[model samples]
Target chain A: MLEVRNLSVSYRHTWAVERVSFVLQPGQVAGLLGSNGAGKSSLIKAILGLIPCASGAIYWKNKPVTKQLNKVAYVSQRSQIDWDYPVTVEKVAMMGRISSTGWFRSHSKHSHLLVRQALERVGMWQYRASQIRELSGGQQQRVFLARAIAQDAELFLFDEPFNNVDSQTESIIFDIFAELKAQQKALLVISHDLSETLENYDKLLLLNKKLIAAGSIETVLTNENINKAYNRYLPVGNSDQRGFPSLPLLTNQKTPELQKSTRC
Target chain B: MLTWLTEPLEFEFMRQAIAIGLSLGILSAVVGSYLILQQMGMMSGVISHAVLPGISIAFFLEINVAIGAFIAGILSALLVVNIQKRSRIKVDAAMALTLTSFLALGVILITSLNTDRINLDEILFGDILGVTSSDVWRTVIITAIILILTKLFYKELEFYTFDPLGAKACGLPVNLLYFGLICAITLTIVASMQTVGVLLVMSLLVGPAIAAYLLVKELDRMMLVGSIIGAVSSIAGMYGSYYFDLPSGAAIVMIIFGFFLLAFLFSPTQGILTAPELKNKVFYWLRSLLN
Candidate 1:
């Protein structure tokens, strides 16, 4: 299990995340929802100790997260990577074993087997020799997924794994997420997706520099919570009767489905 | 052709120059591969110039100049990192500020302290033929140490350079790895200061590595190929310098650029002339102009 207590992150004296608290239980897939500049990335970075938290603590398995980094796996957003880097898909997968193989020693045969198994699981084994830059966005994401799988960590954090990925890659990712959850691994995914894909997550945490709601999708997707998270007030009917009030929540630009629904 | 090469070996000064040149060639490329991959090629330029103040100070203190150069080089790199982290200034701007400040300080100390033993022209352009036997040994030792360290930490360094955040999350000591890399780069610059001088050292560091980058898809292969390119350029440049009466440092830099041009124009996978897409684009443009 992972726990964040009164987490606060500041950048240049401005609050990015203020006093946000949440818990991620094992066997749970929680989707972290927030608009742009809503501190989702900052919160994740702070938890990973990539950036210093203003004032907060993160704990994993009852120990400080900083001391338990080996038990955690994080896949940053695709845009943060330099695809032009001169690494083969196989080599990138092999990097997951660097810590386990120890310093000043070559990778063990067991490490190679694990890397091969992870690449095969992601259906990227055939392109193992190709350079990373030659792959499409979906394939690139799959390669990172393979790397995460090879890490064999107890906690997984993904930032926008679905961005720019194809539908096939999307299904592959969901399948892996289901497998990880089945194995009792804790998972937190940051995503902008507010479509029917919300059903895939076991829970949702809505945020706007602070935690607005955290629970089952139906409970967190309330009209008032959505309006508060997005800072938009629409005079639509009561959200109770609306089932899943899929208001054009974050992006401001309405989805085609939302436009059709609004017409009715 | 054999006599031309053998004749230079007969002279002790020529032998020392050749030995130092070849060692520096291999050393620069190996260390330089990381510099270019990190998109911090100019950082090499910054550190090389930053060593000037350290050299002058070391002369005043009667210590080994290489020690001073290494310390100064590392300090400048750290300052650049500090400035970028503490403020909104980007890395390039930080590097520029540090580079000029250290270089100016070095110049002021050199003139103010009357370090008559230090030759400004030799420091700027290099005097390869004047190198002693000890200079040759120092270059060789630095090369061997750097190569061994790179081999021992290959996997960790690869992971750190490719994705620093992911490496850190996986519990790799990325900060230590970065400091180790900076130290290696600084040591390489200090060693090459006599062979190519600080002003032209960036070419030795970046040229062969980038040339190999155009043709290879993996880091290890880049290092291997770049070392060969570096070695060849050094040998050819030495021969040209001995026969044509040109400056040795300028000759080597020219040859390095010559090899880079060849790779840029004819590499199988990425060349402007060899890649099918670029080749067709050129032909199409010419045909349209003719019409």
Candidate 2:
């Protein structure tokens, strides 16, 4: 279980996120929902201690998270990674075990086995030897998912994982989360795809710079609450929106020719 | 060339120079690979040049240049790191301030000096052909020690460079690793100044790593390739300089630049300069349009 109370993050003088608070119980899948620049990434970074917290405290399993972080694992946005890096998919997955072995120790056969199993689980075993840059956007996300699977941590933090991934890969990854949930591992996912999160996550934390609503999906994702959090005077047009916007959908402005490829 | 290789061992200076160049190439390439990956190219340049003022001060006091250079490099690196920590100043600004100001200070100090005990030219452009045996031994010892450190802490360095946040999360002492990297880079720059000159130290620092990136797809392999290319370039540049009456440092830089240009033209993955049909067609169209 992870608990954050009054968590805040500031970039210089600007308060990017303020007085944000949320909790994820063991065996529960929690979704962090927000629009662009709404502090979803900031909150995630604060939870992982990547960025300094301005105020308040975070606790993992009742213990302070300031010093103890071995229980947590992070799968950042795919864009954060350098795809042209001279690394293979397998090598990237092995990085997950680095937290456990403490750099000096050689990667044991057990670690290699775990990496292979994670790749197989994600159906990325075939591309294990392929260079990272050669993989498609969805494939790159899968490779990262494989790394997270190798981490085998109790708490998983994913930031915008389904950005460029296909539904098939996304479903497979969500299935892994479901399995982890069955095993009582706590999962916190930051995703813009609301319908998918509504279907998969047990609880939702609607946020825009601060906590808008935190509870089960039914209680938090209401039209009124979303509008208030999103800071828009008008409604979002549809109560039960079928499909959330994908990255490719946004790229329609760049080249109108690419819109047809994104429809499927 | 084959006969010279066999006979070159007889001459002690040749042996010493070879050992110095080989070790320096190997160590610098190993570290340079990581530096390139971190996008800290400018940081390395800053640390390298900033050491010059430290050397000048050390020279005035008749102290060891290595000690002075290390101190100066570390302090400059710390300043850059701290400024990045506190201020909203971009890293480029910090690097520019530290490197240029220190270099200018070194130049002013050199101008103020009256003693013939230290010639500014020697420090600025290097004296590879005039390297003392003792300097060669010192270079060898330092290079070996650095190589050992790299091997011993390869995993830590890799993790820190690839993902500082993750390394910090794992309680891996990210700051210590960062400090260690700065020290290693400082040592390389100091040792290499004797051969490549302080002004052109970037050739050894960036050349081999960029070359290796062109040829390989794994970081480890890239390091190996970079080390080999650096060694080969240094030796070829030294010999070419010997034969053609060219400046040794500039020759080395030119060789590296030539290889970089060649790689740019021929590299399969990212070479903008090397694609065959695209280059010809683009140039032809450009010529026609201009006409």
Candidate 3:
């Protein structure tokens, strides 16, 4: 179990995220949603200790979260990587074990097998020797997914993973998330894809600097809450429809399935 | 023909210079590959110039110049990082400020000291023929230390260089890794001081590494190929300097540039003139001529 209490972050001395609280349990997928500059990335960075939090206490397993970083696998945004770097997919995937492999030592056979399995899971084993720059955008995302999978962590935090990804990658990510949840691993995904895919998350966190609401999809996606999160009023769905996920945005697809009910 | 090669080694100074040059070549290529990957070429330049103030202070206090230079180089690197952390200025802008100010301060101190023993020209352009046996030993020790540490930390350094943010989030001490890299680069510069002075040191650091980068797909292989390129250029430059009485530092830099040009034009994977796109056009043109 992971518990965050009153987490606040400031960028250049101005508060970006303030008094945000949340909990993540094993075997669950939580989605972090917000508008541009709404402190989504900032909050994640604070939790990871990549940036300093102004005031917050993150406890995991009844202890400070910092003590248990070994059980955490963080997949940063694709934009943060250098594609032109001279590295193979196999080497990139093997990086997940660097800390555990210890200093002054190379990866053991066990670690190698784990990387192989991770690459195979993402269907990227054939490109193990290929340079990272040669892969497509979706393929690159899958490689990063392979790295995270190889970590075999209890908690995985991914930042904006599905941005501009192909449908195949989208399905792969969803399947992996489902598999991880089945394995009792906790996942926190930061995404802006507000289509039917939003239904995949077991829970949603709506944020606009501070927490707007936190609950099941049915409770958090109310028209009043969405309006408060995006700072613009949106049409409300049927009030009694509390059992299923709501498609909040209309995509380029012409399918009438969600064309009228979802708009961002 | 053999006498030309054997004659230079007869002189003790020539032997020391050659040993120092070759060792410095390998060190610079290995360390410079990291700099090029991190996009810190300008920072290397900044540290190289920023060592002057340290050298002046060392001379005034009668301490070893190399020790002074190492301290100054590292100090400049830390100052750049500190400035970047505390202000909105990026590393590039921070380096620019630190470099000019340090260099200006160095020139003033040297002038005020009125020391005729200090030759500014030799310090800037390098006097390779003046290399002593101790300089050769320092180069060898620095090379061994750098190579051993790089091998020991290859995985962590690779991960850190490829994706710093991801490495940090994975519980790796990324800040320490960054500082270690800075220290490595400063040590590499100090080792190379005898071969190329502060002004042209960047050429030694970047030229061979970038040439290898265009040809190789792996960091380890890149370092190996770059070291080979650097060693060859350094040796050839030594011969050219011996026979033609040319300035050794300028000769080495020019040869390094030549090798870079060759790689840029003919590298197997990414060469502008020898890639598949150009190969097909050239083959078509040859067949048309025959027809």
Candidate 4:
């Protein structure tokens, strides 16, 4: 299990995230949804200790998250990576074993096996020798997914893994997410997607610089929560009328209920 | 051709100079592969020039000049990091500020102290033929240590440089690794200062690595190929200097640039004139302009 208590991240005197609190239980896939500049990435970075938290704490397995970082796996936004870096797909996957292999020592046979399995699982084994820059966007995402799988960590945090990925890659990702969930690992995924893909996550956490709602998908994606988080007036609605709760139309636009509502 | 090479070996100073050049060539290229990959190639220029103040101070204190250069190089890098971290200023601006300040201070100290023994021209453009045997040995030792450490920490360094956030998430000590890299770069500069001097050392560091980068698909191979290029360029440059009466450091830099130009135009995979993609683009642009 992973827990965050009163977490706040500020940059130079301005607050990017303010007193947000949430808990992610094992065997659960929680989707973090918010509009642009909503502090979603900031919250994730703070949790990983990539950025300092203004006032809060993160705990994993009843210990400080910072103390047990080896148990956490993070895939940053694809835009953050240097795609032109000179590395093969297999080498990138093998990087997951660096911490485990330790300093001044070569990777063990088991580590290599794990890396191979990860590449095969992601259907990138054939392209193992290819340079990373040669792969398409979807293939690149799969390669990073392979890296995360090779890490073999208890907690996984993905930032916008679905961005720029093809539909096939999307299904592959959800399938792997299901497998990780079945193994009782905790997962938190930050995404801007609000399609039927919401069905893949067990829970949803709505945010706009603060925690707007946190609960089951139906409970968290309510009309009021969407209005509050997105600052757009959504018509009042119940889960039964919409089949499943979806954010209402903002401004002069017609509500999603009036149009063809996307169903899972 | 063999006599041309063998004749220079007759002189003890010439022999020492060749040994030092070869060692520095390999060391600079290996260390420089990381610098260019990180897109901090200019950081080498910053650190190299930053060593001036340290050398002047060391001369005043009667201590090892290399030690002073190393310390000053590391401090300047740290200063750049701190400046970027503490403010909204970007890294390039911070580097520029630190590079100039240290260089200016070095000049002031050198002139104010009246260090007649210190040669400004030699420091700017190295006197490779004047190197002693001890200098040769020092360059060799630094080369060996750097190579061994690079081998030992290859995986960790690769991960850290490629994706710092991912590496940090996996519990790698990224700060320690970064500091180690900076130290390696500083030591490389110190070693090359006697061969190429401060001004032209950037070519020795970045030239071969970039040339290899154009043709290679992986970091290890890039480093290996870069080392070969560095060694050849160093020896060829030395020979050119011996026969053509050109400055030794300038000759080496020119040779390295010559190799870079060859790779740029002829590399099978990424060559401007040779690669299909680039060739078509160039032709298209030319046709459009003409029509």
For model 3, how does the per-residue alpha-carbon lDDT over A143-207 read when each residue is reduced to its tens digit? 99999999888888988888656789889999999999999999999877566677799999998
Residue B202 of model 4, lDDT score: 94
Q: After superposition, how far is residue A25 of candidate 4 from its true place, in Å?
A: 1.0
Candidate 4 lDDT by residue in tens digits, B178-205 = 9998999999999888878999999999
**lDDT (0 to 1) per candidate:** 0.88, 0.78, 0.85, 0.88
Per-residue lDDT of B1-291 in model 2, one digit per residue for the tens? 787555655667666767777877787788889888888788878887888778877887888888888898888889999988898898899888988888887777766753335665766677566678878888888888988888888777876787676667666788888889888888888888888877788778888998888878888888898888888777777666556767777887888788877777688766775556677889999999999
The C-alpha stretches of model 4 lying farther than 4 A from their native spots are A234-264, B278-291
Q: List TM-score per model, in order.
A: 0.93, 0.90, 0.93, 0.93
Candidate 3 Cα misplacement greater than 4 A, ranges: A236-264, B277-291
Query: Model 4: per-residue lDDT, tens digit, A1-264?
Result: 899999999999989899999999999999998877789899999999998999998999889998888788898888889998999999999987777777888889999999999999999999999999999988998999998889888999998888777789989999999999999999999877666677899999998899999998888877788888877754553232432333432122222332221110
CA lDDT, candidate 1, residue B32: 93
Residue pairs with clashing backbones, model 3 = none
lDDT tens digits by residue: candidate 1, A46-82? 8999889999989999999999787888989887788
Local accuracy of candidate 3 as per-residue lDDT tens digits, B139-254? 89999999999998888999999999988888889999999999998898877777778888899899999999999999999899999888888878888888899888899999
Docking class of 3: medium
The better-scoring model by lDDT among 2 and 4 is 4
Q: Model 2 off-target regions past 4 Å?
A: A236-264, B4-10, B111-116, B268-291
Error of 4 at A264 (Å): 28
lDDT of 2 at B223: 85
